[model samples]
Target: MANELTISGRIVSVLPLQTGTSKSGHSWQKQEYILDTGGQYPKKVCFSLFGDSITKFPLQVGQDVTVSIDIESREWNNKWYTEVRAWNVTYASQQPQLQAQPPVAQPVPPQPQPAPQPQATGELPF
Candidate 1:
């Protein structure tokens, strides 16, 4: 059984569908796509949609999307061949916006003290 994996990113390229005949005279077709995950350190991965799956989800380059895939490895002539196949695709918009912050309370100014009024001096009032 193939292990399932999901990844989200923008579409880098949508390669044309490829068709070929197997050694046993069977025809096979597949469509490939490259995704670039925008982040601190960007990453690129190539995945394919096989057979009828290609028509189910029509994808365009430069669009953001989340893709569900299955990982499968096969031994061919003493070498290993790995394939990442997409089974589900969902559109994803750009990063979410940050919430707005509340306004800060301003500090109140200090009030000035009233000056003292000097009445008549200790001496008798003139």
Candidate 2:
């Protein structure tokens, strides 16, 4: 079975860290990003990026892109949580062409109206 999932969303935030003990108690770097999927409402997903992958998916806030992720579900504190681990991300600019958008109609300007002329001071000409 394939352990990969794909999702498209905007990058909301990115956090970089360097605090993990190795066998010799050495610190290692870590990076992650939060993606906001614009669905019926909206959904946010967090994923970890490591080493070269982090550089491959250089994220910026409000950037729209597609991510190829690995998903894992775990139970913690009597609640289930889902994590999206991104393996590859493709920038939107590299994607193929989509259909062209319809042209927008320009708004019509209001026509000028003639000023009303005042009637001669209550006089009936015979």
Candidate 3:
């Protein structure tokens, strides 16, 4: 818990989901996502969700999310590798919902009246 950290950003990409069985014969799954924190100089971070958390957090590109992660480093073959694993993920803020507006009724123009013709005259006047 001491190594836990939180970061918020918009998801730039979603990496392919990885699934395999561990040495203990238990199936595991992991999903990685690239996040971009917009600013004068934006930062990009790659974090992963493991196991059921991957389904619980179901991420998508362009979604703004805040992730709580734990940074871990492990040594393999004399090389140390670091991983940012997200334990919790939530929308940074409530996403705005778009409301459908009712269509406006167009006003109909009034029909023009025809001019009344003068009654027929008996004869032509000088």
- RMSD to the true structure for each prediction, in A, is 12.7, 12.5, 8.6
Best by TM-score: 3
By TM-score: ranked, best first: 3, 1, 2
- Between candidates 1 and 2, which one is better according to TM-score? 1
Full-model lDDT for every candidate:
0.85, 0.77, 0.86
* Model 3 misplaced stretches (Cα beyond 4 Å): 1-3, 94-126
Q: Which residue pairs collide in model 2, if any?
A: none
lDDT of 1 by residue, 1-126 (tens): 655679989888988789999999999999999999989989999999988888897777877889998888999999999998899988875633335478899999999988765566756433
Worst ten-residue run, lDDT, model 2?
Answer: 92-101
Off by over 4 Å in 2: 24-27, 73-82, 94-126
In terms of TM-score, which candidate is stronger, 2 or 3? Answer: 3
lDDT of each residue in 1-126, candidate 3, tens digit only? 276689998898999989999999999988999999888899999999998897788787778888998988999999999999999987857653336478999999999999766557855443
Give the better candidate number (1 or 3) by TM-score: 3
- Separately for all candidates shown, the number of backbone clashes (residues 3 or more apart, or on different chains) is 0, 0, 0
